[model samples]
Target: MFLTPYVERLPYPSRTVQRAIGVAAVVTQAGIGVTGSVVRVTGSGLGCSTWPQCQPGSMVPVDHAQYQTVTQWIEFGNRLLTFVLFVAAVAAVLAAWRIVLDHPSRRRLVKLAWTLPGGIVLQAVVGGMTVLAKLEWWTVAIHFLVSTPLVWLAVLLLRAFNEGDEPPRPVVPPLARKLLVPLVVLMWLVLAAGTTVSGAGPHGGDPGTHRFQAPIETLAQIHGGLLVAYLVVLATFGLALMRGPVPAEVWRRYGAVWAVALAQGLLGSVQYALGVPEVLVALHVLGSALVIIATAALWCGSRDRGAPVSGTPAPRESGELTPAR
Candidate 1:
């Protein structure tokens, strides 16, 4: 009885609301990665000096001689973003659940929606481990690497909201489609190498943090080589696309991927040349998130999933509403 009135007054969420939730899910997922980089580059990785708490005695940041107030807040702020991401994830799950309850045929969306919240939980555990481990290079690398797949899933969730649950049909030619497999794998490789370079480079999140054992120069060369290989594969995929007619949307997405990759490459070059300045390090991390988003968009756009199915009826001019199931 206590909750009945609130439940009765709640309006059914429209398709537009669901799609907006999807978009929010994607943006928040990507935004958190950039913030994590900020924590690292600012030497605030251990700003709170403990996980699940700012310090041993406090959950919130406190004035401490051992840590600067600004640095403690920076790290605590990043931790707080996990809750924002969780909120987006919960909204996505609720939206998908409502749709599936009304139209069972759209049940597949629920699975994708669930992954967002699950991934956020996993990220939280890894983040805590990174702090507990004293910001070890590999733990930090793992923390950053986890975002790639979460970002990929977020993009897929957004695409699902805009399209049907039907099986994907490729719009690109067979060669072009097949080439994307390698292209995607190479993208992950480049990301891993980039993280490795960060591990060995100057920024270790803390002044006394342990770095990877390899020489920074050697790691940089390896990361650069992988990037060059990824570019060649992308160029080859473009040529394959040229062999046959392709959808305009596919071309646009492909161009976006190319544009992001090229700009990221340029930024990486400048970052390296400038001795990995703190500001550029943050920008480079943001660029990495963009590259993930752009490539995921390209992959999703390469396939056709037909039109979206609406769970709720068209809105009445008088704005009378049905309660969500």
Candidate 2:
């Protein structure tokens, strides 16, 4: 009792403590993406027209004739989100530290979570360059794409934490499981294509920014083709899973993955047909996040059963069942 004040404390159970902080990193990361889209769609990409400082001779924005208040607020506010993301990342890093000895296998995850702060730093630098370069398509596109991967990493961290100190064991057969990795790769290829389509679309951050030379229709077609391929691959996996005597939870996650992919496709089509309305564009950005999360959940669910989850029979009411995260 006397040592309490001197000793640093770790949360009990280690598995479920402040887990919301890890998950919040996911949401805030996605939120930043959506808000960035808002900045692009609203043509406020160059609102500040400078970085590190909102304008010349001022770290904060000052009302100027060239840049209006609304645009400045949108762009600057979106930039401010990096701080929120940083705080969440720090929380995750701290949580990871407590569990390293208990879960040595999760060292990789701890390393990845540690990367978030550095990634945010790089994001800030890239963002500054984007400003100096007048929001060029590649710079803005690269910045957007960078955040997407960070979201995937954060998901991995959350899953690892959810599993706590449990050592990982294969949930499915080692042979049949090889299919999932390629499917995930396909998902990322499709996302990259979508970002490229975004770069070519009418919204390139600012009105005067350079755009991808390809016609919007052609970019949409390319994106659609990749998406269709990804869906087919994922659907094939789901069908194979269904044919086997797998756990009910696998089926549930499979169905969920399909639902999310289809919904994202529908959003893409509607947005294309409607000429990419601002509201739809923002929703589509959020949909990108949904697809990412679903795919991640499915993949993570596939990797390991550990104790019992995602392919395990439901426990009867008479029995106690601890979560096999």
Candidate 3:
């Protein structure tokens, strides 16, 4: 199952090769999410018009006067990209298998890697439901919601490869360490609220698709309020990191979190004011992916990952609490 037979047989894939695989997995995952937004915006959610097949009896597109060529191509093309995502996920698992098998600390990478393929399988099933249900708002919401955490998982896997097998040592002080998990939870809540808003908004995949009874403005306000709260908490944490004796790495990552959160908030405001243009909605989707990654990446930086044998991270010098996942 491994791909080393045609090449040199090393104990594990070189760090460089493994890192490349990590990048590939993330990009492919993000690509799928963005293309899904395209499917929504273009109203091509059912370009193929059937589940497990483009048409009733054919795996390919059939000429029909009802379905335009462009719409059919866009939808089918999105389906084709699923195979690309699957290939990337499988490659990730294979690339890191040997290390996972041999090293105790490295076993965590294997678990995270497994999620990539597993998530794709689940996403496939959900995609089938979306097609079968004619892109119902809840089905579509679940479809988008599934990708959000997978992005976090993909980010975590990438971080693990670089973090090494150090004992879970957290660098942030206890005073600061307590705030990180809440940020993650709040991020998810914001995502859920945003999805609720989208479900009630003008974009419903197909023209005649049913929408949630919730008020879009009410949902937008709730989503915006939650976003503000999150930003406030993050900003407070960032300021505390600056004044405190935190590591420079932590400061940089937290800064990135602040930046992404601010950008997303601004986009949300503009989209709402302009009546949620299709283009902005798509960008908002892209921004959501970035926010999840940035939040997860910031938490990752607080981890004092090092070789378990050596386990010599500098953060311990500051007497910070070492939190582990």
Report the number of the highest-lDDT candidate: 1
Clashing pairs in 1: none
Model 3 compared with the native: what TM-score? 0.89
For every model shown, what is its TM-score relative to the native structure?
A: 0.93, 0.86, 0.89
* Residue range 84-178, candidate 3, lDDT tens digits: 99998987887566554344457788789999999999999999998899989999999999988788899988887777765778777765677
User: What is the full ranking by TM-score, best candidate first?
Assistant: 1, 3, 2
C-alpha positional error of residue 177 in candidate 2 after TM-score superposition, expressed in Å = 1.7
- Worst 10 contiguous positions by lDDT, candidate 3: 308-317
Tell me the deviation in Å of residue 178 in model 3: 1.0
The alpha-carbon RMSD values of the candidates against the true structure, listed in the order shown, are 3.1, 6.8, 7.2
The lowest-lDDT stretch of 10 consecutive residues in candidate 1 is 1-10
How many pairs collide in each candidate, listed in order?
Answer: 0, 1, 1
Clashes of 3: 1
Ranking, lDDT, top scorer first: 1, 3, 2
